[model samples]
Target: MAGIGFELRKYLNDDSFTGTLKAYGFAGLISAGPWVLSIVGVMLIGIVALTQPVVGEADGSGVRQFTTSVTWLMGASLVLTGLLQLVFTRFVADRLYEMQDTIVNANLFGAMALTTAVSAAIGLILALTLFSQSFAYEFLMLANFVTLGNIWIVVIFVAGLKRFKLILYAFALGYGATIVLSILLLPFGLSGLLAGLLIGHALLLFLMVGVVLPEYPVTLTVRFDFLQRRLIFPSLIAIGFFYNLGIWIDKILFWLNPGTSEAMIGPLRTSLIYDLPIFLAYLSIIPGMAVFLLRIETDFAEAYDGFFEAVRGNATLQEIELLGNHMVSAVREGLFQIVRVQGATILILYLLGPTIIGWLGISEQYVHLYYINLVGVGAQVLMLAVLNVLFYLDKLRDALLLTSTMLLSNASLTWLTLQLGPQYYGYGFGLSMTLTAFLGIILLSREMDNIEFKTFMRSRPAQEVAA
Candidate 1:
């Protein structure tokens, strides 16, 4: 027993065996930290303030309504962020790849400031127009909250920064402060929660700007070459727009159609409450996003090294074969690792699902939603891995095309599922996406094979791989 226990402890602690665990832990802290606190605040503050004893609704109508609204808002936010990311990520990646100091200082910082201003303005307008009249205070608070959230988008550009460790620590501190602040303020009610969120993000924005912008000052003289490079801007915008639409179609439908009240947990019911399950699924993304970002630097380092090695010299047939094999293996391993981590997480969540939700004061219906979201997450992860590899190979056009196709498929499938019914749509969306992703993988794999052959035949000066 002692020997077995010792072996189990070693397996648990080994870094390679537990890399995903550590990665997930880091991701969860940064990504889900704020949202988790928000949920807790909702339970303690919002539920308690509703001033009614919990009872199941007469019909299942309210659930759909709540689901729709939450999904729509979430989906819209997703689309907005995705579009912003598409433009910014590509631009930063290009400038950083060339080690261009002027572009980093001027173009990057300028773009970020411009983007934040535009996003904040839009959020402010939405808050004023939709919310100002009735819920004046809440609306203003929401506006501030969203403005802060949009500003946080700037943090993504840190992807290109050389000093990731310091940047990550900064984010950790920002998130930690946000969590503590949100919790401390929850006692004052929803307004307090909203105010805490506003302050927290405001602080984060300041922290990021202080850490990042001074490192790369914008140049006054604009390079025509740099301006022309903005040709990729359209691709970025399209990518964001479509991806956002695809993610939020179902959510919008639910929001548009809030139905009658239904049981949320055993006997506890609420009208159209969608936030809980969505929040749970969001927990996965918080960690996933963190892992993806953390790995981005390492991936680039490793990918570029391998890429130059394969292209540097006239590849012997053996070298060609090895490269091809490596490409396939890399894709498989990256995806497999994500799957293993996600599966373990799902299992842990499953075993403790009821107890955990109960403790959080979340409704029982969320249990099934949690499972459905996991399935969606798995499909999304696999698709994301495949896309990254495509980008690595510089098949930008093909990658763009695949992403476009997936976006269309996601939107159409999700919309169609809503017509079938609400409870069915979430799961249906996942199933459809899983199918679509499988098709995408097949197409991308073929494209990769073709690209590899053509690159092997071309005679270009190959870059050397670092040890």
Candidate 2:
């Protein structure tokens, strides 16, 4: 509780209001809420699937049936969610590009409606297709529970733009309540946990609707012109496809190869043990945003302006040199801060993560993966942060290219690791991402130096003549 509170405060008190808001809202919706909630659902599915015993060996037939049902449920849910995301992304991206604040709000509301409808439909479908006679009641209840949370998560993110703090507060409360309720009801077993989730989401949705409807003044005018001009639809579609693929690839692997007695195939168990490492990996991002905020508004802003001016008209050598110094200084400062915070977080996770996992009723199989992955994740955060700073310094195109390369590298590495089997899976991803980021930073640094030197040479002659 104290840790969560501290995180909330850190975000709320950040100097960059706009950036903080965006980060807070995004983190809450995508990272904090949906990510965790989806994991819970998937974990449930995995556990239930594994519980099916082999007929000759145990209750094999029942296990097979349960696995089949969970598999179907996951597939249906994912497909529905993906479709909704595509539609919503198109809607929002188009509105945002045109600076159509009114239409954006309307689109957001429309998105909420679409999401609710989609989630509910998916829930119903799951109940019908996935729930068996024996477990039908339990499965239906679980479907409802996960669906309700899904709906609220999407709705809140869309409506959460300016009211960043509100979004954070809502998510913290919603998930916190869910966690508490889940723990409290665990004595009653899985059914109780499922019911608790349904209730928690229902309450959150009610609160979110009440808060957002009153706070926002939305208008019903939408124009897709801005998006059309940019081909944003295709761009977003591609990005979304890749993004989802990146996140779920590992999970897919695990589900396919969960080992003896486990139906899943991946190295990382979808079980409670994996939670610590995965959660810690996620937590590493908190400080990355902080470092980014500090660097951009201060050092990068100055460097960018100077770089732009030099580009528009050749800058003097002295001017370029000054810019280089400023950039270097900024990078150093930002990295120091990032390393400091990241180290602290890693230490805390190292010491307390096991205890937390136990408290959450997670099994012990995932501890090694969780801790190691968290470290790799932290290193990746640092690398990514540096890349982001470079981007802010008027290197958007290069940044985009670097990002593309990183994804490509990650894909190739992940495939190789999978071929080699579970031992190398996450390590490959972590290493590749970090390596790519470091290479990018090195290239950017050289470019910065060259630009600075050129600027100084251009300015030196003018100064000499003046003297």
Residues 1-467, model 1: lDDT tens digits? 12322333354456674754665565445444544544443343333333322211244232232222223333455566676665665665666556765566565555555555665676667665664333634453445535444544566665335444444556555556655664565455444545555565566667776766676654654333333543355665676666556655544444454452343322223334444554566566554544443343244335445655766767676765666666556555556556666667667776877887788676676567667766776677666666666666655556666667766666677556557665664665576557656866786667656556666565532221111
The candidate that achieves the highest TM-score relative to the unseen native structure: 1
lDDT for each residue of candidate 2 in 273-351, tens digit (9 for 90 to 100): 3323554576556655555444543445556666556645776756656766776776767677767777787788778
Supply candidate 2's per-residue lDDT for 424. 59
TM-scores for all candidates: the values are: 0.72, 0.59
Worst 10 residues of 1 by lDDT: 48-57
What's the CA RMSD for each of the models? Answer: 7.7, 9.8
Which window of 10 residues has the lowest lDDT sum in candidate 2? Answer: 260-269
